[model samples]
Target: MTLLQSLIECLGPSNVLTDADAQPYLTDWRRYSTGCAVAVVRPASTDEVAAVVKLCAKYRAPIVPQGGNTGQVAGATPDRSGTAVVVNMQRMNRIRDIDVDNETMTVEAGCILAAVQQAAREAGKLFPLSLGAEGSCFIGGNLATNAGGTQVLRYGNARELALGLEVVTPQGEVWHGLRGLRKDNTGYDLRDLFIGSEGTLGIITAATLKLFPLPQTQHTAFIALPDFESATLVLNRVKKAFGAALTGFEVMSEQCLSLVVKTFPEQRMPINCQRPAPEWFALLELSDSEGGEHRRDGFELVLSDAMEASEIIDAAVAASESQGAAFWHLRESITLALAAEGKCIKHDISLPTSRLADFVRDVDAMLLARYTGLRMMVFGHLGDGNLHYNMLAPATLSKARFEQLEAQAQALVHDQVVARGGSISAEQGIGQRRVEDLRRYKDPVELALMVRIKQALDPLGIMNPGKLLA
Candidate 1:
């Protein structure tokens, strides 16, 4: 029988989608990349997944392992060959175990991120890997990308949060390495290899994730700042004041929040307009084990001192949990708002915290000087030095006309990033979107080692071909 027929047999006919059924799985989340597949198969268990992989290996058909279909970089989308089999893990959604005493939870690859967070909450613990697509993104996808979200400053990325992983190799063998121990210096860390491999190396079937005690009290604040320098000052001050209690420190350009308020009329800005509108804003959170008025008083006191020091232009502290959510809602709405406006040139970049201020000022001037009608929308986890620096075309330009400028603009931004000891792709892994950029900027020696590792792990290269490595 053919590969399609074999896949259908392994995972019933209903799970083996084709034609229109397979269309949804072919396109990337941003609709930028679309490819055809022989069949899209949903496997319910690790054994079933291994069976599918073995069948594909026997057929020599390319395999693209997908999770949630919510990736921004087309990493999960199949290519246009129409000969690849898309093995989706949505059906393997299960919470295998929750070790509350050890503060770790074992969950299947297909568990939705938000569902995992809620599960931890029910267990009176916190799984702090949060992002804009948490509602739809899967745990496996997060691991593949080594996703960095708001709480990354405190808890760390998906890689650090994960203690163990169950992966099916490109050769169809299952490596069950789910050790929940905090310290394991056994040998070559296969878990770290697969965590950010973007599914090019193997299929991650499940993981044991780190968890933390739920804070007794959490406070959120929105501060309007005069400029990027002042924002950095406020960041340093808060870092000194709160230390580990500071859960997150996010920064947004004035244009970013204004776009959110304009696009989503229902959502209100947290800051009052008694002071002149500021150029930048910082949204920070403090999580404390100790509750009561003292925690909040300390938070307010820091902001008051910052305002007095001119580090802050104005401040709005959340009075309740709902208000805190609302404050974050504004921050989260940025990408959606940009999507609504038009095509955007995006750069997920990170720099030394010290260099961020000068980098932004210099790059902003350079881009505006070169391009007449480019609008900037910058924001991100300032605490971690990752910024989503994006640009929109003038209203006069059509989609095609605007997209033509993407390559040149991206090169300009990335060149500056590399010059100042920064990364072109920070939290978001270099999927199909930034493959060429990775090739262009990555050090020759480091790139060679990566290629050798890819060859060593995947000899056939039938796994997620044309991603990460050329």
Candidate 2:
């Protein structure tokens, strides 16, 4: 059979799509990259996926494994060449097992992050890898990128939460390594290799994820802080007081909040704006196994102490569940609001808590000094040191002029990030977006080791080429 015929035969005609039908898988969420795929294959089971991949291997055709396609970076997007086959994972959605006693869940790769969270909740547990794209982004994509989100303060990254993974190797063999054990000192950790490899090494078929007890009382609050320094101070105070119960701590500039409220008027500002809007806003959440009254009391006490110390200028606590959701709705709207603005240059960076406030200040000052009249929007998970620093064109500049400064702005911001002993790409993996950045900044020895590993596993170089490593 012909390659196309072979794929169709292996996955059924309905599962194999081409031409205009395959257009959905061709582009990325941000429209940053668009590529042609000879066919977009949706396999229902691990066996079907392995078969399709084996067929591709026989034909020497490349495989680009895609999940949700919600990543900002074009990690999952294919190249302009149409010779590759796109393996869409949505059809593999399934929560195979939820072990309540062991506190783990084995799930198919295509399951949406939000669906996984809901499944955990239904089982009286919590899957806490909450991100903006949770509603659509797949767990496989999360594993591929090693996604980090708001709850990293308490729960940790996707790498930490995933106990084991089932991956389809480059040669189409299924490596079933989904072990839920907390301690297994085997040989080299192959699971960690694929966790953040951006699908360059292999395709993750499913994962065994760790779960935690659902919080009995989840209190949410939005606090207005004098500046990033004060925001950090408030975070330290809350962390010391609540310890593990402090589930989330987020920070946003006043300008960032303003843009969101302007774009989505329905998303009312969560923080009280009594003191000239303050310089920064911190959204705090405390999830305790204790009763609501205890959680609320503890949350209120921290706020009172912080406010008295002038760390928090003003604050507003969520009075109801709907109110808490509304607060998060505002936080999530920041990304949408940014998109509505003109062309923007974004950097997902991380820094030590001690240097984070200073890094933000220095980068803002540096960018403004160099690119006069440039608009910036800064926000992120302040608890875990990730910041979404973005730059936009001043209203006076046209889109073309704004984009023209992306390179210069990116260079300045990223350099400052590194200077402060921080990472240029924090939560967002080095997909196609910043592959060159990874090459430029990553250590020579380390990069060589990564390339060696890639060569060792995918000698044919068929697994999602042109990502992570240059």
Candidate 3:
């Protein structure tokens, strides 16, 4: 039998998609990276994945491991060469086990993030790694990307949440390391090796994720800070006052909020009216694992203190569940509104919390001087020091002309990020989108070591080729 025939026989024809049926897996969500693949194979279990990988190794065919395909960096999409077989792991969706005593859950790679969250909730737990794409993004993809969402401030990123991982090696060998131990001082951490490797090292088939007690009184509030600088001060004040209860702290500039109001009329401003809209807004949420109404009172007191200190000009507290959802809707709509605007140059960078305000101001100053009629939108997880700095072309500039400035804009912002001791790709891994940029900014020695590790793990260079290491 041919290579495709073997895959069909192993996985059954219903699971192995080809030609017209595989178009959805060929393109990325951003529609930025388009590629061709011989077939899109859906393996129902870890053994099947191993078999598929072994067959691809025999044929010398490359394998692009994909989950949900919701990654912004096009890490899951195939290349245009059509020499690759896309391995879709969604069919393996299953909660293998939930160790309530250990506070951990063993979940298959294909499980949706939102579904995992729901399962944990039903079991009286909270899987805190949350993002707007949680509904469709899979657990394996989250682990592959080491995704950081709203709760990174208190809990941590996807990397920290995972206690153990079961990966299928690039050589088609299964390495079962799913031990939910809190401390194992054993040799090198092989789990870390694959967590953020972007499938270049191995395919993560399952993971034992860490879970936390569900917050009893989760409170969300929207406050308009006085200026850009006030955001950091507000974050500091909340951290000092609320301590561990402070789960999230997000900041958004006036332009970012205005875009949402303009695009979606239903998402009117959350806070009551003032003389003029505050220059910036900060969204805060407090949560406690222990059940109590005092947690709610504490959050209210913090807002009062912030207002008294002149840090906030206006504020709105979510008194009910629907109100909290409405507040978050405004924050989530910013990205969708940006997409609606037009093509934009997006930079995800991290900096010291103290320097975030200045970075934004200085970057804007320099960008405005160089690129006339350029619009900027600033927002992101203020607590974690990551910013989604986006630049849009003014109407006078043509799309083709604006496209040419993408590289220059990336360099301009990244230069500032590095100077401030920050990272270019904060939460998002350096997939196809930032591979060249990673080369431009990453330390040579550090990158060389990573290359050595990749070579050691995938000697054939068939695992997700032409990604990460350049």
lDDT of each structure?
Answer: 0.92, 0.89, 0.89
Q: In candidate 2, residue 356 scores what lDDT?
A: 90
TM-score of model number 3: 0.97
Worst 10 residues of 2 by lDDT: 270-279
lDDT of 2 by residue, 1-470 (tens): 88999998888899999998999899998888999887999999999989988998898888899999989889888898888999999999999999999999999999999999999999999999999999999999999999998999999999999999999998989999999999999898889989988899889999999999898888999988888899889988998888988999999988888999899887788655775668789898998887748768778988998999989888899999899999999999899899998677899999898899888787788888887777779899999999999877776777677667887788888888887788988888988889888888888999999999989998888998888874
Q: Model 3: clashing residue pairs?
A: none
RMSD of each: 1.0, 1.3, 1.3
Q: For candidate 3, give the lDDT of residue 206.
A: 97
What is the Cα-based TM-score of model 1?
0.99
Per TM-score, what order, best first? 1, 2, 3
Q: What is the number of backbone collisions in each predicted candidate, taken in the order shown?
A: 0, 0, 0
Between candidates 1 and 3, name the one with more favorable lDDT. 1
lDDT per residue (tens digit) for residues 69-107 in model 1: 887788888889898899999999999999999999999
- The residue-level lDDT of candidate 1 at 194 comes to 95
Model 3, span 173-261: residue lDDT tens: 99999999989989999998899899999899999999899877778999988888988988998899989889999999888989999
Q: Please give the distance, in angstroms, between residue 294's alpha carbon in candidate 3 and its true position after superposition.
A: 2.5
Name the lDDT value of residue 297 in candidate 2: 78
Global lDDT for candidate 2? 0.89
